[model samples]
Target: MKAFLILEDGTVFTGTSIGSAREAVSEIVFNTSMTGYLEVLTDPSYAGQAVVMTYPLIGNYGICYDDMESARPWPDGFIVRELSRLPSNFRCEDTIQNFLEKNDIPGISGIDTRALTKILREKGTMNGMITTREYEDLEEPISRIKAYSVKGVVKATSCKEKYVLEPEDSKLQEPVRRVALLDLGAKKNIARSLVERGCEVTVYPCDTPAEEILASCPDGIMLSNGPGDPKENTEIIREIRKLYESDTPIFAICLGHQLMALATGADTFKLKYGHRGGNHPVKDLETGRVYISSQNHGYAVDPESLDPSVAVPAFVNVNDKTNEGLKYTGKNIFTVQYHPEACPGPLDSGYLFDRFMKMMGGNE
Candidate 1:
């Protein structure tokens, strides 16, 4: 069936429908990863957005259920240049077409994704609609697209109940450390990363209070990545302030990184076009080392807004010189705006997880 992608700017791209026939309107963003489409689809961080894959060909390797970062796909819609009909992989269990149909996600394929990405790059990210319905007048859809905003997405994507993940190695009699993970729409791999390192991870919902988490007597705390503006989570930020006062080691990622900054009196702002891909390069200030990292966030901590006495910039993005990580002064806390537990990206920054383990005294 014929589908139309109506942008907020009134530009419409015609394509063939690939998923559900239902219409979807969302903040449109693009990702540059050539592979890992499955991981992108399931990542909780994409909760309120429709993703445009810049890579021309997608799903050639098919979908492997083990690669999923969350329980279900989170994107409001999907856009791609071409959709692979026949996937050839030894571990393939399902095709992208079937996955989208089962998940009820609307998508458009065979469109000029390069041109769409160029427009987004020049004009910044904007809202758009994907529908199989033909419209003679684009005024209504464009207005609706412009009016859309991503809100309450953190609450919507977060886990409803707390759970625990034990160490992956059964041979280990007791876990090396106990970790309290505050899940702000966390990807499953975050817990798995700690578990693999022999930590008993207790995953808490985003709304869990600081006192309750402190009562658990965890050796360390982990604030996870999520969706939406960090400033909107004032209550949670207050709790994080309490956590900051504690001596227990703390490590945060993405949205958590932004919230940690806000809790400490630092400010955050939306990016013109947020980083969302597998190959973003970040440089560690302390070591002067560059590492290709996986990232997905729309907001960033304002380095200038940080107080020198509270924290210092630890890493920076090579592309835009934006803040990528921070180290709290006189505190056992460190945070990064990129994904260390990369599901579909380079593992160069995976050592940060080990650094967290060290902070928890697991290495000792």
Candidate 2:
């Protein structure tokens, strides 16, 4: 069916509709990953956004159950230049079209994705709507989408209750390490990586209490990535502050990293365009090593607000020199503003997960 995407700027692109023929609106952003469309679609962090893939050709490998970051697709819509119908991977179970159709997510293809990505890079992320049936005048819908308030995006995408993703019995060599994973819009890959390392991960909602988290007797804590301003998430910051005195090693990523900074008396601010891609470069201060990272967040910890008594800057974004990682001076707390559990991105930073394992007293 004929479909089109309408940006808030009044720019429109026509393409072929592949997923459910329903109207959808979301903040429009682009990703530069060359693969992992399935994981991107299921990631909860993309909840209120329409993702545009810059790689052009997408869905060539089809979709598999193993790569899902959530139980269901969460992105409001998807856009690509081309989507392959035939997938050749041995693990392929369903085509991208089938998955999106089944999940009621709309997608449009055959558009100029390269041009769209360039525009996003130049003008920053914007609101957009994808429609199966076109209306003569798109001014109203575009305006509505542009002005739409998508507050509490973390709540909208977070897990309603606690759940576990366990590892196989044969994979366990010792008592299952317990981890309270605060799901401020967590991606499943993070939990999966922890499970693979023998940790029994219990995902909790964004507003889950510090008392409840302690009651779970977690050996470590994981704060996940999500959307929106970090200063607005004052409640979660309070909860994390309560956990700071404990010996539990706290590890955070992206938005979680920003919250960790706030919990420790640091501040956060918005980025002009923000980082959202697979190939961001970061420098590790201690090791003097660089790593390519996957990132998707619009807010960052203020470098000037670093608390010398509590923590110090650990890693920095090479592009904009933003605070990308933090290491507490005395506590067993550390965090990175980039994803180590790469989905469609590089794995150069994946070793950070092993570092987390080491902090938990697990031999890698």
Measured by lDDT, the strongest candidate is 1
Per-prediction RMSD in angstroms?
1.1, 2.0
What tens-digit string does per-residue lDDT give for candidate 2 at 1-364?
8999988888889999989899998888887778778878887778788889888789888888988877888888999999999988998999989888999999899999988887777887788889977779877887788786557788877889888777778767476678889999888789888888888888999999999998878888999988767787888889989988788988999889988889888898877667878899999999889899989887888889886999999999988899899999998889999999888689898888878877887766
| TM-scores for every predicted model | 0.98, 0.93
TM-score of model number 1: 0.98
Each model's C-alpha lDDT?
Answer: 0.93, 0.86
For candidate 1, write residues 1-364 as lDDT tens digits. 9999999998899999998889999999999998899999999999989999999999899999999999899999999999999999999999999999999999999999999999999999999999999899988888888889999988898899988887866724344699999999899989988887888999999999999999999999999999999999999999999999999999999999999999999999999889999999999999999999999988899999999899999999999999999999999999999999988788888889989988987772
Q: What is the lDDT of residue 27 in candidate 2?
A: 83
Off by over 4 Å in 2: 165-169, 173-176
- Residue pairs in collision within model 1: none
Window of ten residues with lowest summed lDDT in model 1: 167-176
Q: What are the runs in model 1 whose C-alpha is more than 4 Å off?
A: 169-175
- TM-score (C-alpha, index-matched) for candidate 2: 0.93
Report the error of model 2 at residue 164, Å: 4.0
